[model samples]
Target chain A: MLRVKNLTVDHGAIRALHGVSISIEKGQLAAVIGANGAGKTTLLRTLSGLNKATDGSATWGDLNVLHSKPESLVRHGISHVSEGKSVIPELTVSENLDLGALWRRNRKESAQSKNEVVELFPRLGERLSQRADSLSGGERQMLAIGRSMMSKPQLLLLDEPSLGLAPLVVEQIFQSIRDLTNSLGLTVILVEQNAIGALKIADIGIVLNLGSIAATGSAAALRDDPAVRAAYLGF
Target chain B: MFEFVNTLLIGITAGSIYSLMAIAIVLVWRSTRVVNFAAGGIALASTFVGSTILEITGSFWIALPVAMLAGAALSAFIEYFFLRPLLKRSGDKNQEIFLPIIATLGILGIMKAVLHFIYGEKIGVLSPPLSDKGFIVSGESIALSPLRLLILGIVLLLMIALTLIFQRTNIGLSLRAASFAPEISRLSGIRVDLVRTVGWAISGAAGATAGILQTVNGSGAVTPEAFEFSLLLVFGFVAAVIGGIESLVGAVVGGLTLGIILAIILMYLGSSLVFFAAFLILILVLLLRPNGIIGVKGGRRA
Candidate 1:
């Protein structure tokens, strides 16, 4: 289980994530939907140790992840795939996937993880020799998620995976996310601007407005909620 | 035909050394976004260490590896003490690359002064380990000597090793990932700081090899104020720039092109035109392909 309480983050004086609180059970898929600059990315970055939390208590299986090094977070079975398709463009697709398992001491285990990720995204299996830069937007995002899975994370955080991708591509990516949570028993915290799509695939939905949580409920209830639909879902 | 062949031999021999230096420059640039002007200075210092080792052990082979080790240590120290802070302060801006370039130039000046202070009275000698007598072909001697062949072999081995490291290793992936996208790499759990230091170490070792080769290949001596060392720095940078300064393969091609042209110029146009011809070649290439011969087009300022 993951727990975040009274989390406040100030990005060089402009407070980004307010004193927000949330709890997520293991294997649960939690989608965070918000407007631009509503601190959705900030929340995930802080959770992943990319941003310093001014005040917060985030406990992941009894570990205080606040202010820890980003590398340390992955060791504790947590991984964050931030905004944009974040694969190393200069490296070949195989090399990029290899890096995700770098910290693991057991080479055989990382190889197993690589096999799993490749099984999940078979396109990566075909493009192993090609450079990551040659990948299309959808393919790059797939590589990014595939890389995160290479770490064999118990909990994964994704930000704007559907950004700039076509509707068909977005559906395919969200389907993978669904499969990850349902079959692999992986917990997920997804931050998205595509509220409707994210909510449709999500198990629970949390809405953020101006760096504060506006609503939280089951994905169906939040999708049906008139206030959430009027503001975020575009009812 | 003999004259042309001799000229080609001379160019290839000299170009291989320049390629070593250019590889060092490119490695440093790719890893830290700094041109590493101090490379020349550090190499000079490492040569002095090589000279000391040569005196103690009386073996060129032993001196060489020690010098390379000294280079790696000094390079890592500079990265940890100097470049890391400067980069963190500067961030990854195209314009900010100039800051480190200038900072490295300042470091170069300091290293020159320090080497002069330590070894000003007597210059260090690095005699060729192998015979310099050119191989005979059809009753005429060509420019290809055993020493030059040895130099070529060493450079080839290093390049091959580098290729393997970058293409087939995990550390290479981390270095590439960290350089290309630090925030993402850090998120992916790569120790970017440690990787940057390692990159500098590799660059330093390459620079040290260039220094030893450049010293023995020519007058067989090194001085803190030697104009030859400065020429190495300049030509290496020019070669790296010509190669597009981003890719290792580019560095090799640029070095060979610069070297062959200059050698040919010296053969026909006089030694005076060699430097002038180099400048002209650099200008022509840059004007034609601003990004370099093999540099990526429209990429970040590499």
Candidate 2:
């Protein structure tokens, strides 16, 4: 299980996150939906140790991960697929996947893990020798997710996975997410600006407004909530 | 035509040496986004130490590694103490892009002064105590000394080896990823700072090797009559630029081409035009191909 307790992040004098608290049980898909500048990315970055928490702590099980180095976070089995196509563009697809499994000491295990990643994302398999930059938008996202999975993380923090994708591609990605969670029992913290899509797929949904959580419930309840419908869902 | 062939072989050999030096520059540039102007300075320092060691011990084995180690340590210290602090202030528009360049020049001055303090003002010769023999082909003898041949062979091996590490190794993958996007690399569990340090150290090693080789060739030395060390740096800079600053091949090819051109030009313009010829060729290459002959636009840092 992952726990974020009263987490507050300040960028100099600017307060991006204010005393926000959240928790996720193992193998649950939790969504944090917000408008622009609502601190969704900040929350995930803080969780992943990219951003320093001004106050409070993030605990994965008994370990305090607040001040942990980003590299250590991978050993702890927490991987973040960042915003933008963060794939190493110069690295071949196989090389990029190999990097994702860098922490694993055993060469045989790492190779096995890579094969698993290729199996999960067949598009990556066909283009193993191609550079990451040559891939299209949808393919890049798949590669990014596949790269993250190369480490076999206990919890995957995905930020804006569906950004700038066509509707059909988005559907395919969401389906893959569903299948991954079902087959792998992978816990996920999905941050998205596409509120409706996120709410639809999330096991639990938390609506964030202005750097604070405004609402939290089951995904269905948030989808049915009248205020959420009026303000965000375009009902 | 026979003279041309001989010159071409010599040029290629010299170019190969320059390529080694350029690879170091490119490595540092790719990782830290800083072109080390003090590259020659660091190399000179290592060569000085190596030469001093050799003068006392007369052992090539001990001196060579000691020089490389000194270069590695110096490069690491420079990156950690000097450059790391500047990373925070990197985006300042007022500072201009040339600040790092100028700062490196300051480092160069400091390095020269330190070298003078430790080694004194005397120009020292470095003899590897090896066979200074050349192979004869078609009644023409090539000055293929064992040390020179060894140096050329080492450069080729190092280039191939480094390329494999970058492409196939896990750490190399992390390095490539980090150079592309630091934040994302951090998220993926890569120690970005460590990768940069390794890059710098490796580059320093190349510079050190180049300095030692030049000294042995009698082209790099410090003396009252001539400061060959300074000229070697100029040659290295020209080579780096000619190879397109970012291309490893460019650095080597540039160096060889420059050497051949200068050698031929020397026949006409005398020794005074060597530096001028090197820079002239470099400027021409830059004007013709801004990225260099083998330079990749935006991949692998260099």
Candidate 3:
């Protein structure tokens, strides 16, 4: 399980995330939905150790992850797939996947992880020799998620994986996300602007507005809640 | 035809050294976003050590490796002490433009003074194995001076080896990623500091190697004034910029093309007009294709 307590992040006096608290059980799929600058990304970045928390603590399995480095986070079973694809454009698709396993304690285990990822995303296996920049939007997102999985993280933090992708491609990606969580028993914390799509796929949904959590519940309850529909779900 | 073939071989040997320096410049630029103007200064320092130490021991081979090691150490030290602090303070705005460049200039002055202080103001000679030798190739006299050929072969092998390392090794992949986008590399578990350190070390080693070859090839001597060889650095920089700072192969092509052009100019015009000839070609190339012959169209800003 992962626990975040009273987390606050201030970027030069402008608060990006308020004193928010959240927790996730092992192997759960949770989604945070919001508009741009609503602190959805900030929450995940802070949780992943990419951003410093001004106050509060992030604990993963009794470890205070707040003070941990981003690299160390992966070893502790948390992987962050950053905003905007973040693939090293010049590297071949296979090399990008290889990088995700850079910190793996053992080479053979990491190689196995890579094989598993390639199996999950077979398109990646077919295009392993090609540079990542040549991939289309949907392909790049698959590569990003696939790369993150190469670390064999128990918790995957995906930031805006659907951005800049077409609707059909988005559907395919969300389906893959669902498949990954169900088959691999991987926990996920997905941040997205596609509230409806994210909520449909997520087991639990949290609505964030102006850096604060406005509502939280099961995906069905949030979809049925009139206030949430008016404010975020676009009822 | 024989004269042309001989010049081509001579040009190839000289071009290889330039390619080494140019590739180093590109490596540093790719990782740190700094042009590393101090490259020449550090190389001069190392060359000074190699020449002086070799004169004492009468062994060029031993002196060369030690000099390269000294160069790598100096580069690593500079990165840790000087560059790291400035990078910390600058914080992403191109504000770091002048700090290291200026600090490096000061280092240059200090190194020049030190050379003068230790070796005195006179040019000191270094005798390598191929000081005055030649090999016959294709019924013509080709100067296969062992030192010159060794320098060329070593540089080529190093280039190939580094390319493989960058493409095949994990550290190399991480360095390439960091060079492209540091924040992403850091997030992916790469130690940005260590990668940057390796970059500086490699740059220093290459620069030192170039300096030693240059010192031995012409005049067989080095002086405090010999350290004033910014022309080579500038030529290498031009090649790097033209080659698309991100492309290793581009650096090699740029170096050879630039070297051949300079040599041809020197062959036609007198030695005094060499600089003028170089400037003319540089101006022409810049006017025609400013980003360089092999530089990427729009991606990186090296």
Candidate 4:
């Protein structure tokens, strides 16, 4: 289980995340939905050790997630896939995947992880030898998620995985995110601007507005909330 | 015809050394986004170590590797204790590059001053390991010699080894990934700071090789303020820029191109025209391509 309390993050003088708090259970999928600049990415980045929190405490089990380095967090079974197509463009898909498991010493387990990633995203399997720059945006997103999976993290933090991707591709990626939680029993904190799609697949949804959590409930309840639908979901 | 062939051979030998120096510059640039002007100082200091080793062991073979190791240590130290903090404080903006370059120049000055303080009035001799006498071809003595051949062979081998490391090894992959996307690499569990240090170490080794070779290839002597070392720095930087300052292959091409053309100019025109010719060639290429010969269009700045 992962717990964050009273998390406040500042970008220089302006506060990005103001006293935000959320909890996620192991194997549960939590979606953080918000409009642009509502601290969606900031929240995720803080948890992943990319952003420093001005005042907050986050813990994954007994480990202090706030103080640990990003690389240390990966070893402790937390992986972050940042916004945009994050794979190294010059490296081949195979090489990028190998880099994800670079710290993993067991060759057999690493190979197994690679096979699992390939199975999850078959397009990546076909383009293993191709440089990532040649990959389409959708394929690059798939590679990003696949590369994160290579670390075999217990908790995965994904920021806007469906951004700019086609509807069909976005649907496919969302389904994979759902499958990761279901099949692998991995906890996920997915930040997205596509509230409806994210809410549909999420078990729990947190609606963020103006850097504060406006609502948090079961995904179904949030989907049924009239205010959330009008304001964020745009129903 | 014989004179032309001899000039070509001489140019190639000199070019190969410049390629190693250019490679050193490229490696540091790619990893840290800093144009390391201190590379020449690192090379000079390491070559001095080689000279000492040669004096002790009486073997050029032993001196060379020891100098490389010393170079690697010094380069890594600078990256860790100096460049890392400076970069962190300044941030990664492209416009902010000048400060780091200036910082490196300061380091270069300090290194030279320290060398002068330590080895003042003492010259380090680095005579050729093998015979410098030109190999006899037909009825003539060609410019190619055992020492020249050895230099070419070593450069080729290092290039091959570097290629294999980048292609086949995990460490090399991390180095590439860290340079390309440091944040992403860190998220992927790579220690980017450590990888940057490794890149500097490799660059140091290459620079040390260039320094030792330049010394032996010329007057076989080194001082704290050697004109030959200054020439190496200038030509190497020009070679890297001409090759686009990004790719290792581009460095080799740039080095060879600069070397051959300069040699030809020296032979046919005059020694005084060589520097002017280098600048003219660089201007011509930049006007034509804007990027070095093998540099990609709109490549990643970091």
- DockQ of each model against the real complex? 0.66, 0.57, 0.53, 0.71
- Chain B TM-score, one value per candidate, order as shown: 0.96, 0.87, 0.90, 0.96
TM-score-superior candidate, 1 or 4: 4
- Candidate 3: TM of chain A? 0.97
Error of 3 at A217 (Å): 2.0
Query: What is the DockQ ranking, best to worst?
Result: 4, 1, 2, 3
CAPRI grade of model 3: medium
In the range A1-235, model 3's lDDT, one tens digit per residue, is: 8898888999988999998888888888898997788899999888788889999888888889899878778778888999999788888899888888887747898789888988888899999999998998888999999888887888889998999999999999999998999998989999988999999999999888888888988988998999988888787
- Per-candidate clashes come to 0, 5, 1, 1
Writing each residue's lDDT as its tens digit, candidate 1 over A37-83 gives 99999999998998899997998988898968889899888899989
Candidate 3 residue-wise lDDT at B267 = 60
Candidate with top DockQ is 4
- C-alpha RMSD (angstroms) for model 1: 1.9
Comparing candidate 1 with candidate 3, which one achieves the higher lDDT?
Answer: 1
Error of 4 at B186 (Å): 0.3
Q: On residues B1-302, what C-alpha lDDT tens digit does candidate 1 reach at each position?
A: 89999999999889988998999899898887888999999889898899889988999999999999999999999999988888778855865777888889999999999988988878899988999999999899989999999999989999999989977788877877887888888878888889999999999999999999988888889999987799899899889889988878888999988889899989988998877787887898789987888766877421
TM-score of chain B of 2: 0.87
Q: What C-alpha RMSD separates each model from the true structure?
A: 1.9, 2.7, 2.3, 1.4
Which one wins on TM-score?
4
* B1-302 per-residue lDDT for model 2 (tens digits): 76666566565566666666776787777778786878878888888788778878888778888998998889888988888777757767545356777778888889888767765767665775566566777777765657567777777877787778876777767666777777767777778889889878888988888777766666534432236556666777777777777655567776777777776776556778877777777777778866666666643332
- The DockQ score of candidate 2 comes to 0.57
Query: By TM-score, how accurate is candidate 1?
Result: 0.96
lDDT of 4: 0.92
